[model samples]
Target: MAEDAHGGAEDANVRGTPPGGRGSHISRDHAAGPGARGADDPKRMEGGVLVSIGALLLGMLLAALDQTIVSTALPTIVSDLGGLDHLSWVVTAYLLASTAATPLWGKLGDQYGRKKLFQVAVVIFLIGSALCGMAQDMPQLIAFRAVQGLGGGGLIVLSMAIVGDLVPPRERGRYQGLFGAVFGATSVLGPLLGGLFTEHLSWRWVFYINLPVGIVALAVIAGVLHIPVRSTRHTIDYLGTFLIAAVATCLVLVASLGGNTWAWGSPRIIGLAVLGAVLTVAFVAVERRAAEPVLPLKLFGIRTFTLAAVISFVVGFAMFGAMTYLPTFLQVVQGVSPTMSGVHMLPMVAGLLVSSTVSGQIVSRTGRWKVFPIAGTAVTALGLLLLHRLGVDSSTGEMSAYFLVFGLGLGLVMQVLVLIVQNAVSYEDLGVATSGATFFRSIGASFGVAVFGSVFAGRLSDRLTDVLRGQELPPGLGADALKSDPKIISELPAALRPPVVEAYATSITDVFLYAAPVALVGFVLAWFLREDRLRGSVTAPDATQTLASNPVERSSYDEVCRALSVLGTREGRRQIYEKITARAGYDLLPAASWLLLRIRRHGWAEPTALSEHSGVPLRVVIEAARQVEERGLALREGHDLVLTEKGCGVAEELAGAREESLAELLGDWWGPDRPTDLVRLVAELNSELCGSDAEQPYEESVPRPAGRVRPGR
Candidate 1:
């Protein structure tokens, strides 16, 4: 018995390793305690879970902190290097590489284990940090930063994905509060840290700082992260990965370089643009055929997942882009120092902190995550418009209100996307699904920052040229170079200072004017994001582990089937009464069984055949079918008979333990995935919702079980 227990433990240990990695390199075997006990019992999932999660909290903070910290430091880096024109590339490069690689990390994690992949990401981050610190020129710095970004993408998402692996989604809110708090707190801290380094230490040390922090994070992951690993057949989808990477890179490049390094109408821009379109189409082709596609083409067929991804993309595009330029506005246009800008932004950060914490607690308690996004996206659009109207004469009070709106919107929608994606997918696909969501958002943020940076630059130039309409100065210095750096503007011969500042102000205002409508697109996308009913279950602590389908509960299945079969008989033809009686015993038998059989039959059989088989007249079956559905026994699928969730479960149980019975049913369906579809009961859902009306066009055009059909419905 002890050996068997040891073997089980051994098996679990092996499962923690992902598919093809340096095996067991970073498996943190500290389970949250098996049963409630002394302080040492780890698997109990009560107290020790908190301590480990606290460490996880710190680890997540490390990743979120890096994104914002670098933003405030960009201008300072340019000042030190005498390469003011290269500032946008620094931010663009980081986003471009990170955005493209985000899906890959998630895919690899799916092949291996989340624990190992996260550790690998930390190590890669550490290496990139060293390279960034050593960079001597603008181009080298941008290149190294891109490398750092590759590692950074996986760190943020894998941390969240790990939560789903260990805990249920409902209970995850308290922990999600930790994630929100970390993001909120870090936004404030990152800029402060960046300012401190730029002011006292060299700006290069900003890159160096990540080294020690990443090592500490690596140690925490080595000690406390615990998860189960199950060995399974694995296939990496190379064609899909290549195609996706190509399109993502091209799209980001277009955003980053268009209207800046290359004209919007330039041949280079047009070529990359066409290349991106072709790559995206090719990506769809690869996804369709790959057995383990990074993106399941079928997932797009799922309304909830696709809408959530779209909303996430649009939100990232508008929000991140707008926020990235906000600090630049404070420093360049308003003449606020970096430290002061970070402090001035406190109201926005505070609003995010408060709203997200409160929302997390409520969502944790109620297990409802859909409504927040529907409303939050609307709020976000309002904030974007408010920010759009900002200018040199805009009051601090007005600015604060705008920032508050932006913060509130972010607090509401940002984390909810994670919840929606988690709810919509099965457990086996958790890492990929979570990664897909984060990937789109990352792509959005990249485009947002890149495109907005160009807008800010262009507006600044136009304003500068307009303000200097009559002024003539140095021989070769054009308006573009003069307006490039605020520090240079401050030092520009004292006479040029006021006009330069005015030009900066005009450009900043123009950028805001342009940013307003971009945010509205996200608002419109969010409107279409469907509200999915949360499947209430025993397990739910966080977004990741909230929606795992329970194993087949055989006894419940048997009771439901027997009761339903008897109730269907003429001797006991009262399904409503049987359902009511079964409810008292917690059997839920008759209704569940009846629904299961109908779904299996799928109204594919003619009404006469169904009537003959079940021993009921066709007319009575049609009339009473509505009542049968009310009891949750069966569903009337258009003009045919179908089963609901309750019905499907009962039928599976009643199908019996005999191979002949299995063959009789299985042999008729040539579709390889039919068994999997049945197990998930994904098809048993309403065709209007889960299945497409277009997919069964042949069924519609030829005939239904009862009569001829048409294309539309």
Candidate 2:
């Protein structure tokens, strides 16, 4: 379960709005206006929010789990359905449908409403799951998987978007971290779970298991999840989407069926190849003319984006290809059970998790990222070479060692690809560039699975035919039978089993051998990737949260908000207040400055309301209010506190100071040449930063007076 690159891209799509889009309204509502509602509003009830979030997480888990869970069960599935040649289609269909449908789901949710759409997605996913579990043949299963993937894509994109509606910007990072944790957990647990169900119950359980989880998620969402729907017109790139999907379909078909189902130079293969090329050209043309392109073609013009995309594709090609075939190798050739194969794969999973975490931390710390991708691709190539050496007689220790190496290599590169793409693009291209990077990785994964199947099938056929030629005396145990059902090898006579196992081993390992050079290509391209200074937002500690999840569809505003939220959290409250006050040239306590900014943001605030909303002690808030009033910075009108003329000037100065500080942290991203959307984003974020009570000064920072002589100051 190499990280689902699709998740990262799709997550980005619906999380925020485009420059002049919904994000502007949200920022204005949350920050710049008197009508701004606090995230801690009593009407919302914290308990209900948590429950709703839990339901959303469950929905995301179902989508993500399916990506890796099926790997361990593929062997049993092919065995049950008897279509070894179509094994890759099971994975390819899901990926292809999900990838193509991701942007559409995001747009539809935006146009309609996410809550209802999310419910619809769940129902669709559950229906698809039921159909998959009940599938009687390989074609039916593959078709059902496509149905499942369509829903799965919606589940991933909308769940994240819905979180944006439920929580304020300040808390988004913390919750997105939860989503990242889900992806991380699934990466390790999916294969294991699939193995457990396939071994203990049946392979069908892998699909059936989604029914209960999806049902609960659907019910909870329908019952409790409520968010305002702001209808916006969107011109979806329908022609572009169709052309690109057709292009991918044609290419995948050409790769998967070219050598096995049809000859490489045969009419069908040639027609697919020619059709893919024509569709690709047509897709490019349509993208140029589309009002809102699915993937902007201009992204390819940037050197860093292009290079990162190439590396991402190659990484996906190697990672998924290996993940898909490794289980078959262990179960068929090494004679390990489904569950044991999953257990044995843990070394690789552990290696990937460790390396991904370590690499992300290092990048966050130093702001230097080129080294990881370069080293990762190189090690990946080396790891694949190591895996190619695995054989039927290979020791468990040796096999584990190779798997760990491959996983480490993959981990080192996976997270950095998105960061570099984000850094390389301008604010305008930020959302698309992020999505584009992961999109290529996903497409690469589809191609990898398809290509590997083609190679494995072709090689296994030739090897099995050569080894078992003229020696099969059994009734129904033919070469095709052995290919269709690997279980038959165990039933083969003792003398014939050795050569047959050798055939399977050589065919599977040869896939790794062929893939090693592809990884090497990534290693070479890695050298060409431009090294750029990481943006403060991109290098924030919680940045990994953004990268680890399924991030496919998000807007530039949401992307920036999430990153800046992490940056704001990382920079403690006291320090941030101190910096703003210093920059504003105000000689006041940080708490007083915080109070002025908050009052300015909401137009008016009562000291009691401020104390209650922000977790600061009432005494401390009254004291700060006293100080501001003493300075004539704010005036008391009945029970509400409003900034005076001078206080308004000071608050504006402080707001400007906060914006400047944020801009400085963004490096070159902020400046005279900065995009208008970015300028708006920084302003909105400044308001959000002040609006959030989570960043209020600690209770210990301002102690209560020994004498409690103040009722209303």
Candidate 3:
């Protein structure tokens, strides 16, 4: 077993080694773990699962927050750095680097290990953040921001990848939905936080704020996460990585520059477009020949994956396009402060939070998920259409309703696409598949932002000219200046300001009108998506089957499976509480009871671990622990905790009660005379959240009696 586990495999294609020169070398043994099933299976909770997940989620938030946070601080940054001509690159640089590095990071995580890669990414992000904060010039700030993006991209992708490792697909809905909610929350929070920091502290604080929070996350992940080092041998496709990065850079440049910085037909724009195409072609050609492709071309062959990618792109396009202009409509047209405009966006974020959370829970409960995207994209298109109808006289409430509809639609579709793609791919391909989907989305956002910027610029210029007619502007003011310096419009003479504000409103609305068709395309694509079953088993995908196949292990496996499934549900939690209450000879509240159990289970734990493991507040855990200690249930010896004689008895009783409860829950439903395949039955029940077994790999048989499309459902 050790020999197989330690066997070395050569990876001659390795590139971009860390400073320590850790090359891409790995080995694996069947006795240690087998297949993607083993690799992707949830690691057994050793008292800190929630903590690890929380830390990873926070890290992802740092990445997501930076994307929007910088927008509010950009004007200040330009003023400080004095490079008005190069202003757009401040944001574009980060977008460009992030988009370029995303796939490379995903592939590297797959080649090595996710935990280490994630940690490295976070460190790089922090370093980049520090440099950005200290940058003296626009050139330096932009360069450092790109550095930040390299790490930021990895953090975003790797966080999701790690979640895949931690939770089975059947149970990932809530967590993934929560991740979506975080992204949505940050969309509103980032700008608000940025404005606060910029106004109260300095624009540099926007980057500096990541320092303490990121350090906490980094420390938590380093201490708690324990992904097994799987020895695997694979070549890293350096050429493919370079080609893909090159293509992404070119595409983002074109998207960011075309018709905004340069005219659409200009040589610069045309050259970048042609170069992007050439690099894309080259990337595809290289992937075909490489030992390991950054994005496996075979993924496109899967209908669901292909469809999801397309829909993700379209969703990003429409969503970003609308978001890019919504503030303009609220602030420039309606004459609200930047802060108030952000406040006005709250309805959208609220809708997103509610819809994403509710939809995820529903998907978890009932395996039917196809309806969400179909309805979501359709609603998204409808919302965009409504926004298109907004006039200069539209009320705040009217705009709020429009934002809510649009946000709800976005929320429903965002995480569901990732779920669909993950469901379609095998465990080994999870990271790359996710990164690929995100790459499309990121690129789509780039295109959306660019194209909409062009549309808004042209429309506003024409509107301003038409509105002004023969009227001359103040010295040093023109239509072009108004487009660039939006604040100047509010300072114009009352007669002139009304026309400019109306013109701004018209231009922004036109962008939304143009984006409505993109959502419609996504709606069409959502219809073509085939819903597959989510994986429900917490262990290796076929662990249930393997145990059932062995006659000697059948009875024991059945018991284990039943116990796990029961414990996985809400009612199961009630059962646990009852077990503890019954054993302790008194009413132990949920937090106190859970803390005692964890203490008993782990022998000793810090106060933080107890809180984290049990999902109790730290203050609650500390108070409960103190109360228990005063009652002679637990005592602290030095820094370690130990149970007394009474405590041990209570622990023993709780354990017995738990066994009894499991036995009762898994007991025969029908009379004992007729035997049932309880093991298979429990497995099926758990897997049911994933839909039918039609899409499961052939080797993993999901047995069903004849003539039932869905047997238990």
Candidate 4:
């Protein structure tokens, strides 16, 4: 790792939680998006959580299933069209259209509605599948495949981003398990189904199979995914779209042709690569200037987004690119049938599913995703090195064991990165940020696959050339066929077999050896990922849940959810403190108390900052400070937010109970745009609850009970 990166992680907030306490619970339901409850009523909030889970499952399926489904069918499709050499295109075309379009799709989902756009994607995917089934040849099939990519691209990102939108990262882990399950099941199952269709039916059934499942998924999503609709319109970034697509296509083309179809020094390859670089630079410039930029350039300035994006790109390059070729090696080199290859590939899928699900749940409960990724990336690097050492003679057990290790590493890190990235942004930016990560991953994965395929093919050809030069090769035995299949090389003239098989093994191993440096990139990024508490207390529509009734739960939930917000994280807590104080009149203690309580409940800070922050009179601040110290909650250490272990627990519980008291005191303060006076009044009520004097202007509320020092006392 770079020295700079080490410093960055230290400065960054990626340290996981501070020993104890979880993420503040906030209502992640963004109004006017997919699966939102239009009302902030309690019944609706409860209903929304239940109904939305089912819908999210359906959406996740769209993303995960699409990625794994086409692999088994690729070889068969190539066979039928007599274009085995161009087989990588099947996956490339899908990734190309999907990745390039990801940002646009996410933006539209936020603008229109997640449900509406998601529904549209499902329809589009089904249509593309239908067209693919009817294709007469390769070109037609490729065109239709691009359509499928469009829908598939949005599937994973939208679902994940929405989870970040609605659920706090800490609590979000449990549900994220569902996404892991879908990905794992699909990865294992897709190949088996694809193989069956290729072997028993036709290669076309792989595409056709999506129709029935697609309909069921669409129905589930349309009915259950409910978000509020903003009555506003947004201008689409057509120019941004054109630029991104152009750059993506050129880069993909260059990677695809680099060593296979054309030499690196060839004009076609050089020109395409240059064009891609220029277009990419132009796209960045356009994004920086666009009014409603398809990619939000500002998001990159944030620490979490930057690290998450880099990690996603590396994962795309290492995992996606490398996995794309696993089946080929099994079938062509080892003489394993397609069906057998699917069975052999199950260990990786199994490992990923188990690890991701557990990691997600642990993250939700502890809000410590930073730790898992660290462990995961380290393991993944080790697994890649092991896999690289495998030769043609390596047994199935050895390869499968290596696959398991790699899968386990991948499972731990993949979805958790998405979880953290999604949590760092506000609901409004959730879709855009998520789509950005997904878009980059798609690009990286596509480029990786193309590059590896070209490199492997070229190395094999070169190796074969050297071997053939000294051999009395049969007049009809061509190097092209032998280079592609180790089994074919094994069947060649006995004297030539050893050198030929060795060449194939070397070519394959070189891909991993080259990719090791690339895989380490994610490891470095992992160190800088933020360790903010995922909010378990973020509630949007739960205002209607009785504040007086569940005061403890309400307070705690509110604290966890809003602490990050109250702390001036996006904007700065000091500013918000001043704003609330100014609006509340000169009763600084009361005003400060309200702000501090809000911040504490959000679990983003030590609650004691409230007393010091009151800036009321020293006497008034001291009294409250004494009360907190007596409770053994928070204490002052100069100006820093200092706390004992006991204090952290107190702060965590305080946030949990605060909501009920708040609901009872400020029953009328829930609206998108309420009077500023009401905001001031809520602050006053909050001050009273914490026994501070920063009351609202012209208020005569009952005072806090005296001599009530709650323990850890």
- TM-score per prediction, in order, is 0.65, 0.87, 0.65, 0.63
* Worst window of 10 by summed lDDT in candidate 3: 544-553
In candidate 1 the C-alpha lDDT for residue 560 amounts to: 19
Residue 697 lDDT in candidate 1: 10
Candidate 4 CA-lDDT value: 0.59
- Estimate, for each residue in 1-713, the C-alpha lDDT of model 4 and write its tens digit: 01111122121222223322222322324211345634444345545665676676666665556676677666556556644445566777887877666656656766777667777877888898899899878778878888888777666546654554554322343455455456556677887877777778887888888888778878866766665654336677878888988987888788777767887899999999889889889999998888877777888888998887777667677777667777766665565777787788888777776786677657755667788878888878877888788877889899899989988887777667656765676544654665566556666777777777777777777887888876666654667656433444546877777766677677777888788777787898799787876644222111111000000011112322232222212222233333343342322333333433433433323334333333344444455455556555555545423445765554434432432334332222334664454344333323222212223111124343344433323
1-713 in candidate 1: lDDT tens per residue?
A: 11111122222222222112111221212111123234323234434456556656665666666677776677767655545446666766776666556556655776688788888888887788899888888888888887887777677667665654554322333455466456656766887887677667877778888887777778866886677764334587767867876787788778767887789999999999999999998888888888877777777876778887877776777666766677777777676777776766777776665665566556535767767776777777777777767776677788888888888876677667765665676544544665567667766776767777777777666677776678776754567566444576754667777777777666655665676666566667677766665433211223221110000011111211211222122122233323322332323323233333333423232344444444444554453455445656455545544555654443443332111222222222314453453332211111111111111111112221212112221
- Candidate 3 — what's its lDDT? 0.63
The runs of at least 3 residues in candidate 4 whose Cα sits more than 4 Å from the true structure, single-residue gaps closed, are 1-63, 109-119, 154-180, 215-231, 363-371, 419-431, 464-477, 481-504, 524-713
Taking the candidates one at a time, how many backbone clashes does each contain?
A: 34, 19, 5, 53
CA deviation > 4 Å runs, candidate 2: 1-44, 540-551, 595-649, 666-680, 698-713
Better of 1 and 2 by TM-score: 2
lDDT of 2 at 81: 96
lDDT (Cα atoms) of all candidates against the true structure? 0.57, 0.81, 0.63, 0.59
lDDT (tens digit, per residue) of candidate 3 on 597-631: 44454344456643443344577667657766776
For 1-713, candidate 2 gives per-residue lDDT tens digits of 00111112222322132122122222333333335656633344556778899999999999989988999999999999999999999999998898898888899999999888889889999999999999999999999999999999899888878877877665677787787788878888988998999999999999999999999998888888878897868999888988888998999999999989999999999999998999998998899999999999888899999998898889888888888999999999888889888888999988888888788778977899999999999999999999999998899999999999999999899878888888889877887788788888888888999999999999999999998888946787989999999998878989999999999999999999899889999999999988988888785323222232223687887788778767777887777887887787766777787888766655666787567656788977888899888878788878767778877777777777987888787777776788787776676566567534756865474443232212322
Stretch of 10 with least lDDT, candidate 4: 544-553
When 2 and 4 are scored with lDDT, the better candidate is 2
Model 4 has a clash total of 53
User: Which candidate ranks first by TM-score, i.e. highest?
Assistant: 2
RMSD of each: 16.4, 7.4, 15.4, 15.0
